[model samples]
Target: MDDDLRERIETAAEKHALLNAVKHESDADVGAIMGPLMGENPDFRQHGGEIPGLIGPVVAEVNGLSNAEKRNRLEDLAPEELAEMEAEEEADDSLLPDLPNVEAYDEVRMRAAPNPNGPWHLGHARMPAVIGTYKEMYDGSFIVRFDDTDPETKRPDLTAYEAILDDIDYLGFEPDDVIRASDRVETYYDHARDLIEMGGAYTCSCSGEDFSNLKNNGKPCPHRDKDAETTLDEFEAMVAGEYSSGEMVLRVKTDIEHKNPALRDWVAFRMIDTPHPREEAESYRAWPMLDFQSGIDDHLTGVTHIIRGIDLQDSAKRQQFVYDYFGWDYPEVVHWGHVQVDAYDVKMSTSSIKELIDAGELDDWDDPRAPTIKSLRRRGIRGQAIVDAMVGLGTSTSNVDLSMSTIYANNRDLVDDETDRYFLVRDGESFAVEGGPDTAHPPLHPSFEDRGARDIPVGDAVRLESGDVPAEGDRVWLKGFGCVRRESDTLVHTGDDLDVVREGDVDVIHWVPTEGVQVRMRTMDGDVTGVAEPDFGDVSEDELIQFERVGFVRVDDRDDDETVVYFAHK
Candidate 1:
């Protein structure tokens, strides 16, 4: 082995030494390794006292190893040692779910198949969050299946691909692979052809409304009696682009009298003349339905468990039917119920939002008012806060409303540790009270032990509330932080006007001096409340602090020097 390789093995050996040391500690203490702890991090190598006798086996298995072997080795150490080792492995960005104990069962395979017909809203965003969570919790593979089988309604937009990927990444998930349904039309066609030859599928020239009526009437179509050979011939012709769009559709040969009409004689494939953006004008023209694509792709990718929202439970049944047809092993599914919000029932869709966007009624999908991942990110919602809310929710198939208020209530607590503090004055132009030269104390911060940052210098500026100044005297309460004296009210607009610097007539707003570098924020606090002048320079993004008087805020977007931030507002 090379010198570097030799050095790596020695490092692994040393890691075991440290693990041994930590295991020998009086307390079964766990050491937190800040970075990669696999090899040289001896702290993780040791077995705790809880499983004292089993450490020998772990050491024997780990002791003489090649540099590469040590790096990739899975621990069969004592229970305590294995737990710590598993934790270290997990922290490396792989959520390996429980491995099956038996040797006969197949590896679990799962995927997330989302339709590209519309922009992915909040609930759609929840899919990746749940998938990533389970991927971490269960150790499974996740594939992003872009279900663009039906090209008719799926709009041609460049932003669609970038938007979906950005949202997933923003929520902290980088899928190992991404599969677009449009690209796999040929694969789906081949599978459909296989089913057709096996007498499991047939084509029907049924009209849309007529087919629904036929389904409701429980009548079998004449096409159902067609021979498999004729069906296969027509299917081939359809693949060769012989059929026009919507002229005919190929469906699985399921019974029309089945209780679930949706399952009864369901369309498995369709002909879409709409040009696919990425696939271009390839040899294939027909495509399989989403559930078909999901079933096939999940097995192909070797996904073990699927953690999807309960809204797709019906979809599971349809996809499961596909699995049953092929006699394929189905993956386990844990469905969390629909995460809803009042007036933002993503259970249906924001077609209205899309319509508004297209009609120019709404500016864009990222409109602050819109309930989408992009808009939420732009509006300063912490990705962590969203995940926190999800984890805390009791898993159920029941729907729940998650309003901006609900999020803010949780996020308010999420941001309560930072040292950032300031007041904002809205509507009023200038303060009647002045600080000509005198400076006053503002307690550094509300709670020194809890809020004040030793890194940031506290300001001692005499701030004033524009509306709090008494019309008669210089007396002013100065609000939450301290009191200020009214020197004079400068009315540049109207000399005698400006409400004559009235007291109690208008509410006074107090704010720190602009020298601290103000940060502007916009959030839904019952309504649209914008904080245009916040003392952001005094706060570090790492410091998750509460804005005593204001709601919870987490600084997400920031400039090199200092600039207004777009933070998660709760």
Candidate 2:
């Protein structure tokens, strides 16, 4: 809005037009052009908060110019000047913060430990991005460890483990190593044995209610004073099928008088006869609790930094006891509060979503309605957009509530420039165009004409969405073409001039040939069957594109006959 900013944008816009010309492109991409301009101008960087607001006006300004005027302006700048400006603007800053204790470690290491009980949601996706950022920042290693220990309650599905790994890989943050906790049951048992032998853990036979009462009263259970040798024997018997479920638990020794009763003699290992999907099966009867296992794994795997939700801060406290007992330093822990995405009404809990999925009430994890990372990926939400959204919120302790618009806006900025525009007519109605051209060549991208155009045949009639058709006698512009007047199921071409249509209050409509590729647009709301440009049929699966006047969509499944795309957003 500032005069200086306007001048800067004008200069950049001219250079953009010229560059597109050099590359033989059809148009300039406003979003693409603004990214560098914003990066180069400190003022733009300071004021350019969100992508939507930051580049919206500059795009409008550039788009307002005539093709002739744009070409004339492009001639103002020399090639060397444009190159220098591009070089100045192309330097991008790292989007995340510095690691807390980078100086203390020779090789920084982090891990995104996911309990593979169900498909990953957006919340779970945050781990890898934050961990991956630290890895990049410190030039370290990232481990994707599956903490699938609780087979009874939070049971691990073998399919989910692979799905999780696939999701992480899709995020562009490939783990240096992958670990399954179920396969390391013996390692946990070894740690349990060490704790028992060191008199840091005891076998408790107290009922759930009795243990709670003792914990609440800050009193140690009768089993707490038992000799380490005796407790070790009980632990061995428990693992050897001598103890029934809930009959005995291995509790790590902590101060009985600790203020938080939950932390006082918390259960380290418990008996669960339910078989693990990956390993041990029915052979292993005891499994370490999350905190116990995570604590041990963190140390054993050499994790130097751990970032997780604030709800698990107590887990850190309990894990510290184990670390203290072993005379080992706990990793630097950073706890952030919950982030509430307003778009999803459901719980977004993996266990809950899994139940619905198993019941056939929902589709797979990639169902658009679900908030899983799989859904986001399928819906054309970029991984970097997700990371940007998460990191923008930062590692804070306060709860943050936000709309999906923030993420959608980020995604829009990411895909807008690259996404080619196409015409789609939902529930189409045919209308013959009198005096219209035999073919229409609309730029694939409005700003970046160098990308070329989609050749759409005029045919006998063009298909327009039922809502897009103008009433008889009303004038409208069939975008990329010129103004036309409707006359009872027929469009009479007024002129091939855009200025006439722009000067008049004519409605702009997107249209496709009546005989084009059939498309089934799968949206979050519902399915919309439409006819798209024939070229859209060739769009590869997972390609992100814009259906002009409709919305952005990702090609989900495609064949020669029909194309299926997931509608991302308008």
Candidate 3:
């Protein structure tokens, strides 16, 4: 091969090697870079035999530099390639399939009806993410409805009404309308009375055990044949607080011998003497069950589509009987199976998490250990990441086992370009370094040098985590500063040329000056104390940042005494 051809081959190999190294954070593979190198430079394919020999040294040189240096060199050598790589890494927000029969409806109105028992967890984000996506796709309205009617069992929390809305907003959705079922008790009562007069519902006074035995045998109770007037009177009496709790329950008439016995004569309304948490429903004792209330509200509010879990298929079956009685068309229903996240060993139950909080095991809804949406947001997870992760699951009915790494990957893409880099040595140990530069200039973000560099002042002594300290007689690179050789108790300055350290295979590590600012990072494992670069103090609260070689974190609190951050992911 001629000299010009060899130079072009080496240049192509170095570009691909630098890009691959920056991506994997490891040595570039000669095999992986070869295909892209030849593909991009078709002229080199004729000399494929000589290409590997010429490119091998170039790949080795590219792999020898630290991750930061690899990125810096890539930005300097082939900035357009770096930009193309980033564009490919950007999160694709169009993962969800189009809603079925979207053209059938004039407006695609949908609702996310979450029971306001507690704040929303990660599991609860799917409904809103899905519904919001459809709403945007069709230019329709999204309703935030609180299904908070069971005042006794799943008692409503007054504070959770706003908390749930706040979570929905954080997930990048704005409710076109907000409805509290507790405030609409009278509307449900009107529907209950109409259904009773229509001979579709009856008041059942059978004891719990007796009804269970009769229903198990596919036999009707004595009250099943009662006239509509008598049943309505009894229901009115129950609503008037004339009967104690569990004495009478309004049942929607259905087939007693249905294959799924749970669908037989399902309860519609029941008497609960326990006062509701909200004042609007405090005077009422009779409340509708979830299926009954949601069925009526869905139709009354003009909901054209329903998206829910497959486990609730029976809800659609039961509500169909009521829809038939009213001569109303049931909305289009889409069901998805349960999604299990591998990271959360704890049950993703609001009641269970509330128990933990009350027992003093968890700090609150925003605790780093909890799976609540607030916890995720507080841990530096972006709303867009959560939305994309949930929507990417699609509307398939098959149960999915997801890993948190999927979420972290999506989050890393969303945060990488914006978050500035800093150094934080956790459980740091001080070490003397003699004759180093007075100031070190590291790019705020290696990909975007236009953002400028952080002028971190260096001193004669520096600190690194205990595990990062080099053994005696070992040489290491003090990132962005210079190379040093550990001699006895101190690291003695050697040279500033990166090629020397790269050629010697010395480790490149991050460090903070002896007078660095204190930082306490809260991670899922536990709290870690450390020191960070002084420029870390300039970061505003809630800003996402990366600790040089450490993981990404969100600043929670910063003060002169101590700076607190939450570890997001590596």
Best by TM-score: 3
**Cα lDDT, model 1, residue 315:** 68
What TM-score do all the candidates reach, one by one?
Answer: 0.66, 0.82, 0.86
Ranking by lDDT: 3, 2, 1
Over 295-371, each residue of candidate 2 has an lDDT whose tens digit, in order, gives 99999999998888888889999999999999999998888888877777557798788877888866888888888
Write the residue-wise lDDT of candidate 3 on 232-264 in tens digits: 999899789888888899999999888788999
Error of 1 at 394 (Å): 3.9
What's the true lDDT of residue 344 in model 1?
48
lDDT, candidates in the order shown: 0.56, 0.80, 0.87
Q: List the residue pairs that clash in candidate 2.
A: 25-449, 25-450, 26-449, 26-450, 27-447, 27-448, 27-449, 27-450, 28-447, 28-448
Of the two candidates 1 and 2, the one with more favorable TM-score, higher being better, is: 2
- In order of TM-score, best first, we have 3, 2, 1
lDDT of 1 by residue, 360-419 (tens): 755677655677777676655666656544444435567755544444444444444433
**At residue 129, what lDDT does model 1 achieve?**
67
At residue 172, candidate 2 shows an lDDT of 71
